[model samples]
Structure formats: structure tokens, C-alpha cells
Target: MGLEASNQGFIWVVRRNNNVNGGEEEKNEWLPHEFGKRMEGKGLIIRGWAPQVLILDHEAIGAFVIHCGWNSTLEGVSCGVPMVTWPVFAEQFFNEKLVIEILKIGVSVGAKECNRVVERIVKREDIKEAIRKVMVGEGALEIRNRAKKIKELATMAFEVDGSSYCNMQSLIHELISYNA
Candidate 1:
């Protein structure tokens, strides 16, 4: 799909495994080699792991294929990039709900169980459909607009008068009082 002409403008980035969490180290090393055989000349950029913040920061990033972790969810939301949600774990399902159902800023890739162990596989058609909806399909404009609005709110949370900022100050004052 990535090598297709229509997807030329998009960059597909993937994280193969978690070496830190005891993912198969040998296979993890070899997986990239195998991956490079197909994706080296193509537009895909595969890595073991890197700071998602850096990738999401790019303006060209339209949608994120995320496992729906809270941090990844926040990064995608705060950056105003709509998501292709594939949540696999406990809180991640809730995060997917928050994005797709509550926040209305993303589309689901329909990953029910955890893919870490391959209980369920999100197929190519599912991926293509989600990507199309996010990048160029019917809901693209609505998704993008909602994401921009969310980005604004996420930004305001960090300002001096924002909820997050005030909450931080309150926590600090409480800690000081306790020490005193």
C-alpha cells in the first residue's frame, strides 16, 4: 500500500518491537533487515522506537497509527493529527474510546485484542480504509477540523492561566505546606 502512487506523499513509520520489554532481540534485529528489503526505496521509515513527539511535530503528518497508549494519544491529540487507532491493552482501549467516541478526533482501525501477541491482526484493507478516511476519505475534513480545535485546547492547558499549569502550582504549594 505504501509503495502505491497515491500514497507517495505520505510517510509510513513503524515500530517493529519492544526490545526493552524483552521482545525477541535477535528477531527484532533481523526484522528491520527484512523490512528494509521491501521498504528501503519506498517512503516507509521503520525504526525500533523513537520519541513519537518528534514525528508528530511534523506538519506533514496527517494521521497516526497508534497503539492508543495515553502518551501517544496525547501526542497525537495535542499535535492535532487524527489517529488510526489500534489499541491493544487495558487503558489503551479507553484512550481509543476517548479519541474516536468522545473527542471525535480519530478513526478506528478495528484492533480489538492486543496485537503484541498476535491474538488479532488488523488487515491491509482495514488499514487502507482507516488511512483513507483520515487522509482523503469522507470524514477527513471533519477529523482535521476537530483535531485542530483539540490542538488549541491542548495548548491552552499548558499556559500560565491554564488548568494544567494551575494544577501544577497547586501541587507544588501542597507539597511545600506538607514539608513545612
Candidate 2:
């Protein structure tokens, strides 16, 4: 599956180090061997545990194929990178619902039978289409711009007169007066 997916020009960045016994070491060894052959001359970067990957920091990473984890969802939203949701289990379905229905920041795979480990393989065409939809389609640029505005607001909230900064100052003043 990895080989086939790689051949289709999609890099597979798997998160195999989360809460599983010896999973990190195993994935570190296996992932390179499994996906390395196809990586020659191709722009493929693999890592065992890079939480920031979902944050859309890489310019080349035009889209995210995620499992709908809440942290991952927020990171993606904060970064203004669009998503291609592939919910694996648990509340991921709900997260997908929010991304597609509420936020309109992404598209869901829409696979039924959420309990099964069906893999929910996505083809190359689907990936390309989703990338195009998020990066080039109508309203995509508007959504990205809105996300950028929100990110700027979050940054500003930590400045001297910002909401978080003022709250912290108030708390410190209260503590000092109490001590006095």
C-alpha cells in the first residue's frame, strides 16, 4: 500500500509513535525501508514524531490527510492549511463533521462503518482533486485568509494590552495586593 501510494506522488507521513509499545523504534526502522525506494528524486520527507507537520508549516505541503485528531485539527485550522479528513476511530468522526460541516475548511472521505480498520485508501485522483479544491477552488482563498486573520489575533492576544496579557497582569496585581 505504501509503495502504491508513493508511486502516485503522495508522501505518506505516518504517526506510529503514539501510545503504542515500541512503536516508535519499529516505525523508524520499517517506514524508511517501506517508502524509501520510491523516494529517490522525489520530494518525500519522513519522520517518526513531528507534531508540527499537521500545523502546515511546510510550503510544499499543500494539503493535510489527517485522522481528525482534535489537536491536529486545531493546528491545521490555526495554520490555514486545508484538510483531507480520513477519520480512523473515536471522536475523529465528530471532528470530521466539524471540519466539513461547521468550518468548511476541508473535505471528508465519507467512509461508512467507522468501527472497521478498513484503511480507507484514497486514490491519487482524489488527492489531487482535494488539493485543487482547497488550494485553487472558489472560496478557498477566502477561507485561508480568514484563518490567517484568526492566527494573527491569537498572536496579538499575548501582547502588552492584549486580552491574555491584561488578564495575567490583573492576576499578578491581585496576588501582590493580597500579600501586602
Whose lDDT is greatest here? Answer: 1
Q: What TM-score goes with each of the models? A: 0.81, 0.60
Compared with the true structure, what per-residue lDDT tens digits does model 1 show for residues 88-138? 878898999999999998888888876666678666677777878888988
Against the true structure, candidate 1 reaches a TM-score of 0.81
Candidate 1: C-alpha lDDT:
0.78
Q: Pick the candidate with the highest TM-score.
A: 1
- For candidate 2, the lDDT comes to 0.66
Which 10 consecutive residues of model 2 have the lowest summed lDDT? 1-10
After best superposition, candidate 2 residue 42: deviation in angstroms?
A: 3.4
| Tens digits of lDDT, candidate 2, 119-173 | 5555556655555566566866865665566657756877889998999999999
